[model samples]
Target: MATIATVTVPRRTPRRVYLERATYLGAAIGLAILPNADLTPATLGAHAAIAGAAGLGLARAWRKAQNLDASSLKTSMRALPFLSAAAVDGAALYLPGAGWDALIAGGWGVSMALLAPLSRSGRPLRQAVEVLEAIEEPEPEGEPEGGPEDDADEFTRTIRAMWERAALPGDTRLYKVIRHSPDGLDFTALVKAPDGKPVPELKKRDVAAAFGVHAEAVTIIESTGGPGWAEIAVTPDAWEAERDKPQTDADWWAHNIGREQGAAPGSTRTGKAERPGVVHHFAKMDDPSEPVRINMRKLCTAFGADTDEMRVFVTDRGNEFLVSVFDQPPLADTVHATRELITPNREGFFRAGTAFDGRPVNGRLYLPGGAAHALLLGASGSGKTQLVIVYMAADSLDGATVWGAAATEDAKLRLAGAHVDRLGFGTLYMVRLLRTAVALMDIRGRMGQKVGHDWIPGAPDNAYGRLSLYLDEFNAATKCPRYGQEITQLGERISVQGRKYGIGIKVSGQDGKVDDGQTSTMRNQLRLNGRQITLNVGDVSAVRRAFNGLISAEDMPEPLPQEYGGSTLTLQQIADGAEDPEDAQGIGGIGWVVRGGKPVLMRTLYVDLGGDDREQVLADLFPDTIGRLTDEETTGLGPLLDDWYAPDPDAEEGAGESSTGRRRRGGGTKKAAARDRVKTFLDMMPGADLDLVLNAVAEDGLTEADITAAYNELTSE
Candidate 1:
């Protein structure tokens, strides 16, 4: 093969380049000719032209490099020390000054070198222009209509409506939502079927798949405009197919009960081990025809008690029959459990996840030993105070003894114990001991002491193990110079060791660094060992320290104090001698337990102490008075109790006063007992005179003024 010579083509220069060379050369030549002429014009012109040409080339090169997005351009410009030297050299050639003329020329040269890379690219300017254009142009139309929140809201509404329509009474968990863009939203809900498979007809999953979400997310939920819809989880094909086509009556029937009809009727069937109607018989046990009868007392005694096909009503008729006597009816049966049995409104505390009749469940029933101690941290109006009262009242009616205290006077007096004796060692005995120094001292001394042991200094005898001290505005308590130590001790004892015995404490407060003197102690006793609940007090550092990775610094900004009332974080529980943390699925890991008269997804907002005879108690009891007596007090209650109703003596028998004549009775024992019973029943009604007492019992305090304002605000709207 013949050898081929490869020519390396030189880079091009513009035709106008010669003009630049000529301009610099002419100037140098003219300068040399006008001067004393120690140098020739040719040499001067040549040198000047060389420098000017080089500078022009450098600038061009720099611009080009920058245009191509050369990363090193800026660095190269910054690193050019030689530019300064070149500038000095160029200056010296025109005006000679010792060795400085050479320095001037060198400086001029260096400046040219630095400018070289600038010519490589104009990328920054182009990028800035592109950004401006993008901002000026309108966004492309026909994107997704709603955001994640809108979708979530819609999804929630859908599921909520479906549940309501199905007439399934229980808690409905919004577990998760899986989305496929341009299709629709899909979500999952969990229901409890204690006895068998939950009744499927009670819950329907309707959705739209065109938008990449389930039609149920849109059709069934409450839409507050836009894409606020909740999507329930269901088969995508069914959802998509139904998007354009309307379902006929036959289709609707098939869609609603097809699965049920296909299922085998007995427990012996493989795919139909659980009958839909049998799953939630307990939640509606009151229906007269219930195939089963479960003792409420027995059911409340343990966490998990069998109440399955063990014989419950299979029909809605007002009759009773054993489960063994029951048989599967026709496939199209539409039986509903009656309201008489297992009504959600009955007295009891139910965990969040439990369910009844294919519905999520909530209600509180006292199991004697199910009491829990909690600490709440948040700023004022965070709803922490209300949460504490709600827990206490609900638990108290369930046979729990509640004792509550708060810094404010109104709070203490309102929630004070109705009958300290009724509060005994196991009843809810809310004590308003936040007033005097002695009371503070008494509580402090009793902080770490167990309830069954000897009374601590300042504490009353028989109050041990019988009290659940609810301290509201804990920061105020801890801030008091005289009472702060007691407060600290209280935190230590309750948070670190209070769970073993029946006694418990729920403390609420604002946030700030704990006093250095108490920080370590609080850490070991309160924060480290206690289950911490933070309500929207978004102090990142404080939260990080209090909860570590359970919550991150980023989440703090989202739960600021201004966002209080709705959000709360519960840290792990640390019992004495325990090694591991609780594993609740949510952030705080403490799944919310609702305690109320009905199905509530909220964290047991407030307890209904069933509005018991608050009016009678309010009219009857006063400080230093015989206090409202129960019906049982009338019998064998002698002269010492007489003054209780002295002014109305013979009003009724057995209406007696206390040892001090300062205390008085209402009437004779017989009449008094009757009145007491009536008062108790009345108290169970709404808006009783003992409203303050009820509020305090239910929420540890009765700030009536605040309550009045809240009531007016709610009613006015």
Candidate 2:
């Protein structure tokens, strides 16, 4: 069976309606004023006729706008009173006497002005008003969509409109499913694009773009009812995401730390008094992209929780803030313990520690193409030297070629081992040592270029066997007179080229070392692919310079005690007493290790230097120190007799007599070359243990007599 569709035609507005709409006010006012003003019958009649005709013509013109006649149900109500008043006044204008007619026209004029805004089709005008209203107000337009009607019915109407819009191929219908108001529509939206298709439930970003608010402020939900339908909500998340971002000190306290508003003045609703929260910013804070355990302190920084008494507590789980700033932390301190440092070096790992909650805190500076150099820094008693010793022990024990230079034979200067192939001391000698290193670096660079590859990441047993220059108190070496600048410049060159040549420079120093451009250049080169430690500095400026000015000193931990020097303290140790009056929040650590251009808190290892471990370590690396050489084996150890002197020119080749003196028993008159060897060896070591030197001389293949003679001659000098 075929169905017939009914066609409806739009109704045209009457000409009078358009005429009245345009000329009603003028005509009414003129009629009212005409009665009060002096005028002849011809003028008054002509004016009345003119006004009426003009009103009719205007109404007739507006009548043609039939498409604009769709009035809203509510807007139609507003149009009613005006239309009625117009009718009443029109009747009064005809029925009343002169003065009363004036009153009626004036009344009509007032009604016309009020009705002007509603003159267009009431629904279009209502929608247009709603759009304007939504923009003009802070809240959305969902507020005024309802009137005195059953909410369920209103909701049904709303959902039905949504479905209709969503189902439509080309039309727009913005109706709320659930307006935030208790009696507003339900959570519903029938979103459709201009392509005559329903827009799918969008992601947060899309929804935010659609609604013109922040992505964080809008929550999107894909309703289960149908396709291309979703719900978007407005929330305060955008504002909350920016917590801990204070524009000023007072702003930080007022907005981030505590309540911005207190109970109304003297109101009965008064509660707790206001207080400032102690602020704690996390060092080495994790990135938001990485998963982190939720905590009060992290949350406080995340979505501002404010109070002056905020106490921060750090635990294995993460950092947390408490309501009481003076309370103990939720976690315990990590105590140091000793263990034999027996671990062999592995790929990407050169050092490991048990300082971080008993877990192995591995230190690695091996990049894809180079071995890591290192810089150790700390104040006195802050453990910088100890750390250096630990590192050297590890490297030496692993068979790395260890070379050391020091200004004095201090305790930290004692790193002698089998792997310590050579040592240099004093300003001039250290400068010479650095100059030699610069030459070696040049040689290695040339070799790499010739071989079509820069030598790097080579094993200890590789061609180079991994050489490391451990410079103790690098600042002292850089201050050598007449050679300081040369040393620094050469050091910078080595620093730049060393990493690519199976070589690394481990430099240790206190503050004030980087006082020159050469030092600064060397520091920058070391910063890349170099392991680093920076202990506590007494002043803010020091920290800023040490940390490269990326952090604020106010956010750093307090300075160390006066008695302490060169030894690092853990966060727990510093916190133990820094804020005794307020135990709420604290972080204490002696220094930080630089990683990826940021400082990570130092996790120092507990090295076992006890009898057995120390002996074993020494024995493994220095078996020569385990026993003494007999004196009979060192009797004749001195300048070799054959090399003691040059030939006497005046004497014949075989003659014992010469121009200066008789030829030596083994050869010509004596020379300083043989004695110089012994002198250089003694100077390089300085105050060497007698037995150890005897063993060294024995290892050098010197006979007992020669060894003893060399030692006696060198000591006497």
Candidate 3:
């Protein structure tokens, strides 16, 4: 994140444009007057010296002001000789008859605005547009050779090959695949008699030959979808013989689709009503021997649970019929806990548990290479609150101080080992808590500098060992007139730079969109921190906000049904506020985890707040921490801040970066003061721009030119 006003073209403004024009004009004028200094070797040497100094000053200053990246800076440095050469070319072509040479010969033709190259205008900030695409896209498994991205593309190809094989001249083509996965393929295509002809029933040996599986592993669904179409579930013999099979949510849904879809207008079947392709989305078999025309729009609509919210259906023409539904039931088959998750390691890594595909997930979010924070977007009853509780419990048990901020005044949690001194809820206390945290962060930074530490959380000297802030119902709080500004500022600071100070944040909200008037930088930084946990938001908008437009309609998480007349409400209804939150209790604990730089569907442990197993469930989750936060002494913090607040009415609201956001400079001593300055500026402008930062820098008595010089010297290399 370097300032690279002059080196690249990512960020641009009127000032940068003016500076560029001035630069060309300045060079043009110098070229227009050069050779008349006797046209001698002495003059040539002086000219080269002047050009070198000018190039270094201008390049370094612009780089510092605009925060150019290293690559761009290197490019500009390589062009330095060209700049001098261009001036020489201009001097070589200048007409001495024009009298511009006569003035230079008399040593009186020096231009006054030539000094303009030294002004802050000459060093105008460069627009740092990130042209570099992300080099890494995280995916689960099977990629030591080519990687998961290649695997995904290959998976799409597999679908094409499967359909072609199924459409073979003699093989059975009576199944439409609804779900595809490495484990099994869920097919919806029926096997009824064709017109007046009798349908050939699948034989065990024939099935084995067609599917490339053993005769013993071939299984058929004789219960649902009338006579023509039957659900076929194929698994390895090893997997089937196990006592506890790897039954997933997709498996659960597939096993129950018969009951949900009502046996597809039944025939004389006598088995339990189970749909043929409930787990169609998880299917991954290839037996096609003929071509299949895949109609994605129609198939997706038919396959999806909610029609109104289901954007697309199944379509296939070789490689175009798949939907990446990492959020739905079959994908995020089940949920586990911190015990099954959060594997504490000496390397300071934690295995966060499985993604939708049943692959292990580990996220070191607070660590240097991690995203620094986790952003959650879930509608009410979408498991946002519960997940927050789990995260807090995990960190608390791992010896991190957890600071919580909620919109309610009387928030109570059954956290087992939480320290009460860190809990702050409601608007006022939340503000005080954040401000105090900011102050603490500032002080700790100075302490870390003294101890020669960069990011050693939980170190003995670091009193606030790995502080994790969990802000529930973040959007609702952001709408507050007075506190909205502060919350936004605190959050932005912690997210953008907190990785180095043992601080991290997890912000959850009903919708993922930023407030209407939020600045671009804040929004970008918010999205930039990609460790997102998106639950069943039940809306296309929330999906886009969380996944960044990389998902499909059928891929959307199926809305959790309402208690009574559950099918009557749609996810859009819940997202648009038409459906009651109480009614839309969210479909289980299914969600997506976009940590490790990739989106993977995941589910948290099953939790029903009103169920009788609540206590036992909590106990199971945190045997050591459950009910451990009973008294002040055990909790470590003094007491719950049920009543604590202070208001600064005169404080300007909506300022993004405050003086409290410490900006690193030349020395360790200035760290606290820099943070205070950042806090002060943010108090004035919620998300301060370059103008605001420069203004604050000036106000602090650090003159712009001197600041520029220092910054250039520090960052130029």
**Local accuracy of candidate 3 as per-residue lDDT tens digits, 399-434:** 666777776642334342243235556765666555
> Lowest lDDT 10-mer window, candidate 3?
1-10
Q: Please, what are the lDDT tens digits per residue for candidate 2 over residues 1-717?
A: 111122232343433345446665775665565544556887667556655654554454455444455433444444444454445444654564776776677776666654543343333434564477445433322353432121334434544443443343334344444544444322334343332245544566544443334554556565443343334564433344455354653334334333213211111111122334323332211232322232344333533332222223222212221222223221123333222443344564644443222245454545567767777766555556556656665555545566677665655345343335566566555655664454445445545565566655643333344567777777776665444554676677678777777677878776634685237767876666576667655565566666663333433433433322122345797888554333232222346654333344444653334445654544453323222112321222222111212332223334332343333434532333234334444554465544434433232234556656777887987
TM-score winner: 2
lDDT for 351 in candidate 2 is 46
Which portions of model 3 show Cα errors greater than 4 Å?
A: 1-297, 300-340, 343-356, 360-364, 409-421, 457-464, 516-523, 526-530, 549-586, 595-600, 611-717
TM-score for candidate 3: 0.42
lDDT of each model, Cα atoms only?
0.35, 0.47, 0.47
RMSD, candidate 1, Å: 28.8
What RMSD does each model have against the real structure? 28.8, 17.9, 36.9
Judge candidate 2 against the unseen true structure and give its global Cα lDDT, from 0 to 1: 0.47
TM-scores of the models, in the order given: 0.27, 0.44, 0.42
Comparing 1 with 3 on lDDT, the higher-scoring candidate is: 3
TM-score of 2: 0.44
